[model samples]
Target: MTCSATTRVALWATLLACLLNSGCTGTRYIPSQGQLASPTPPPQALKGFDGNARVELNLPGGYASPDDRAYPTQRANEDIQNWFADSGDDLTVAVRNENIKDSGWLSMLPYILTLGILPTWLTTEGETVMEVKSGDEVLFQNREPVAYRSALSMLLPSAYLLGSPGTGQYQVMADDQLNRHKQALQQYIQSQQKDYETAVSAGTVQAYRQYLQDNPESFFRMETLRRLSELAPATHALPFHRDNVALDNAYIVYLPDEYDIWFLGPQDMKVYDVLRLSREEDETLLASRIRAANQPYKVFNGDEIALLKEGGLSPGLIAAMIDASANPTSVKPAAVAPTVTSATSGAASPGTPSPAEVTAQPGMADIAAQCAKRYAAMKACDQVPSFGANVCRSQVKKKYSHIACELIQ
Candidate 1:
């Protein structure tokens, strides 16, 4: 070979070797695109939790029937646990054994040679879901995908060979998800400044209707609707539904506070009628909850609920009371002996305060209104739904995503 040709070959070999070795030890990457550069955290309205919160994690399933999964569910579980370990002081996270096909992915690479110039379209996507419950009621749920990206490298193009499939990206996504959940929780507490009681006390059917409309994604939607119907069974007879992906089974109806929330089904059916139709075993349980909250004119508050629970009152019973107090006219009188016992064994104990609805503190309303403006901006933009997905590849994608403000969920 000519001297110059030998020199060129040596240079190519050395460059390739460096690329292969450096790939494994590159500085960790933090993605800047498709995220809120300065997202105003969501508004929340809630009393400080009385005790530590419990979180339950549901594992991810395979996207396709790959006997060998790309992102194993257990690994995702570990990711979540490690995340909470840092920020979750008064919170506990546990796993639910059931699995789901949590996410899917796609890529583009017309020519292998292009891998050198462009990302070889290596993406691994998976969704992680966790739920928090206060008693039987799910306070909220969160599900978000952690997408992994790795460019094609001639030395180790196949991610499996490296045994580290997008590890850094996975960590970033997991941290982001945890932060979002924490923000949502704070916003929830803020929202309570305008609780069902506030909506009910406002007394307009419009108020009830507006509450549901403004918070279509709220966890308390179904129960809120049920309360509205009770306050004005005939006036608020209109049926409403939510369009959000997470709230498929939710709806509103006029049922007595005594009705078992779990007992809902076959819409338009009265509570007593449904109760009569339930299975023998379920019927007994339903009956017990109903009897505890059976008062025709009583509101149930959660704090007072712990006292009643030992007496067999279900957590859902407290939900019914919160709903009842929403009515401006639903008077909260002193707890009477006959009512207490009737509600639970009908034996009254004096000095037990009636379930009192707390008045709204200030500032929460302002937070909610601001979030509304943010939501409006996102809906009006023309770009793709997310930067991570890169739904639109137009020259104007960046400009439009900026208009979007924040991811809509």
Candidate 2:
């Protein structure tokens, strides 16, 4: 029975539509380069049930089948470019090499999975499959989903091994993997050691000192001590003991070769000459010593004091000085008298008041004024008058001394 021409045309059109619809409904093979067409039935509209209705969790669409895995092959390349753009020159070069070797794909997959673009899959007996919802939509089934796993695995791991082929580069690609593992272990050890040293260096002074003391055999400790001596010469005398014996009013003098001399008790009449020499001839060294001595007292002024404070001086030293000053006895006259002790000069006369005494006398305005005049005259002389003589010759000095004597001077 042959159909009429008009009926035959209508029947052929209906059959064509059915065929097209069926093709869209089922999966179709497409080459990697082929463009994908929109799926039939599109996606189903999600439904909500009443509070009491048994709720079944629906796995996201792409996660169901391995074939449906949406590996972001294109986006991965974009990310690599972005990474290189933001990185330093060295890192950029490293990334380029890694990409060339296909290692970039391996490293990127983990990241894509985190972004929800790649679905997780399990492999059993060398076959990889994706989890999918069953027909009833109530249960999940592990089915072999379509994906490019073999290609990705081969490309990524191969690339990774290429750029950093193990500890010693070998011709065999398999050996390169082993070398990388060894190199990684060594790098981790070095990093840990560096962290340990950094932590030790950042600790408190006492802690650092203890470390040095305990590690005296270490070369590093010796180097540290040498540096400390060069920077803070006076630190050698620290941790002073009572038996260390105070120098009375002695001043410290620096010698030619980084050596120091302690001139004991400048206040004593016998050492008065040495004190004078230290003050006038060794002014620089004397100043340094005075500064060091006064450091313990906190109120002493000098460049070292400024530096020590700036470098975080111990609070203990400042507090101790304060405590000492609180006691009246702590403040005493310097041991050495101010006298001219040059080799060309004779000894000072007996009972002569010292220059410092003249300055310290109470109500000594007239004495100070007279002394200032004498100072001018003496300064004009070939040799300046002895400090004791200047004080004794001035009437202003007598008046002030008398006043001081009366008031517990």
Candidate 3:
């Protein structure tokens, strides 16, 4: 038996490749890299939390068999600990138990013998208990199980290039399982916290109210109410005789005048009356009630009047509103102009007021024009439709009617 020169060379090369591959290959529990390096933990990935909780892994020996046999040499402990290094102080995660099993070093021999063609598999199955706590209070506890299947071949030099053989894949699987536990723990904490801190952190009445609405029985209910009162005391002072306290609370915040009409006591009416009558009441009825109530009229400023008009008060009702105001000069009626004009043009009639004596007031036409402008802006009625002028007038009138702007008449 004689061997060719080429065959001898090939055998030597094959032997060298085997040695290199064996040195680089690793099982799921054992990392292929000679030097074990910890990973930088991911950023704050938990929702509704600042990731201010400290995380700890109690798997002291790192990897272990199902029967309590530990693999103290494995870097799983350092890798997991480093992964959660900066996670936060709000939560502490303790690993109570972990088990990892994988095919040993000899498993890679078959892969090396087959050159780059054949592949060997590494499978790991384990169970871990992760316990979450918040300052001596346990928030969540759960058992997580992991099963990972991977293949090793010489075709890819990822292990050699990364300075680790099968460690990357195994680490990924372990991290994935830990992440799931973290997520579950996060959900549990959120349910317990009920976004109370998030709302408080915002420090706004709207945020506090929203928190109350979302979680009526929130742990921080008293604190939320205190904040709400500080931010907007009116919401708390509003007389709420209704069963739905939340709805009544909103009434004061959004419709204080309407709230007065419906909920004010007879004693309160004298002091807090808005004098803006019910929508169902006619101007005549409103005037009669205003006179009978004998309460000081409620005078609204320009901004208040604009808001009232936008709220769908009719022009006639607005005129009645002006009449109901304590400041009689707020809106001078056009009827007063006739007396002033007569006095100015002719000799000064007895008991007739002069132009200077009569304060200048917004006339009906001026009020009508102002209302029209507001209506146009509020409804975009000035913009003719793509359909052209044929439907423009009707559409404009329809919009005016929708906003109860009687300026068209």
Candidate 4:
């Protein structure tokens, strides 16, 4: 069928517009020109935790579960708190809301004229005061400014993208603000690490106290406490126990300063065995082992459990491991004790390659190399005398923790 002259002209114009605007297809933030009317405050160095941090998020009206979203307050609270949940309660994080203005369709004329090739934004602007407190003392408080804009174009499916349109405008703004807050927390935690290591090097009771005082939510608190006890025994006191203490203190157990592994030692064959079991999603054998607690391994600590969890172990298995630790059985020494050495540290050592450090076989070589390289970096970071070696190792392992080599084995 032949088109009319007017139709043909329109078709050519449409194709030209698509080509011209191809660079701006996705729903993304428009680059800010000049300065924002209200600049967001940079995230400050404060007390925070990594994977094992116990955080209690407090919204304006108080705690709200993600599962219970019946009310507007609960729904909004859940949107902000969903990503921040972890294991510890070193600090109480409160998010106070402010006025949020929804700027709908900045300009309609351009979009109409360009036949949806030119995009328009649906924006949500707001500010939130994120206050972190250790007991009654406010450790770090900052204003997190939220300016989220979703680009709408016929070529861009905004609804399918994160922070997209079609949701309640307020919810979109809250989610973006929360994400920014999460990033800030990460930066804040890293900044605090340098000071923590400095305090560790000082190796005095006062230094440890200062670190604990400054970073109420530090992942190194348990380590600091142990040091403090060794330096000044009388001052050591029991910390308040929570429901998930095993999960909370897992960081400490998994990455001890001494690279000691008693079971299947000098080689982390047993460690790889657990990783393999997790990959197979079998927790029954683990439960059976937990029940028969005469196994010649040291009771799994919180950090060990955390490592297992990172390596893909199930929660039930972790719980069983925790129980075995809590209720110990008199372990008879193995008839022929396994060698205990640095070989099980999960990093390659000279002379012999640890089982865990062996290069992946065939097709899986690339991932194994990446994993081994990352673990080596973490080990190097831990070797720095003043650094929180355990903390560094834990954080690094969290990123590339899965035992990829276990797949081939």
Query: In terms of lDDT, which candidate is strongest?
Result: 4
Look at candidate 3 and tell me the lDDT of residue 44. Answer: 36
What TM-score number comes out for model 4? Answer: 0.30
lDDT of 4 by residue, 1-409 (tens): 3568879899998886665344232222322242323323323322223212222222221111222212224444554333333434334566665776656654446765776555655564556666655445565566766554545455544323433333243343444555566666656666666767877787876676676667655646656655654552332121211111222332223333222221221123243344455566557876666446533233455765555555455777556544433333423222002222222222233444322222122212223323433444454543322224434444555554545422211
Task: Look at candidate 4 and tell me the lDDT of residue 264.
Answer: 25
Clashes of each: 16, 14, 7, 8
The top-ranked prediction according to TM-score is 4
lDDT of 2 by residue, 184-299 (tens): 33344346446436645755444444544454323133223322333333543332211111210001110111111111122221122323445455455443444333211212
Q: For each candidate, what TM-score against the reference?
A: 0.28, 0.15, 0.29, 0.30
Which 10 residues in a row give candidate 1 its minimum summed lDDT?
387-396
Query: lDDT of each model, Cα atoms only?
Result: 0.35, 0.26, 0.41, 0.43
Angstrom error at residue 134, model 3: 1.8
Candidate 4 runs further than 4 Å off:
1-91, 99-124, 133-137, 148-165, 168-176, 202-223, 231-409
lDDT of 1 by residue, 33-97 (tens): 45722333322221111123333332233212222232233344554444332333222333232
Residue 289 alpha-carbon offset, candidate 2, angstroms: 14
- Model 3 pairs whose backbones collide: 52-88, 52-89, 53-88, 53-89, 53-90, 53-91, 54-88
Ordering by TM-score: 4, 3, 1, 2
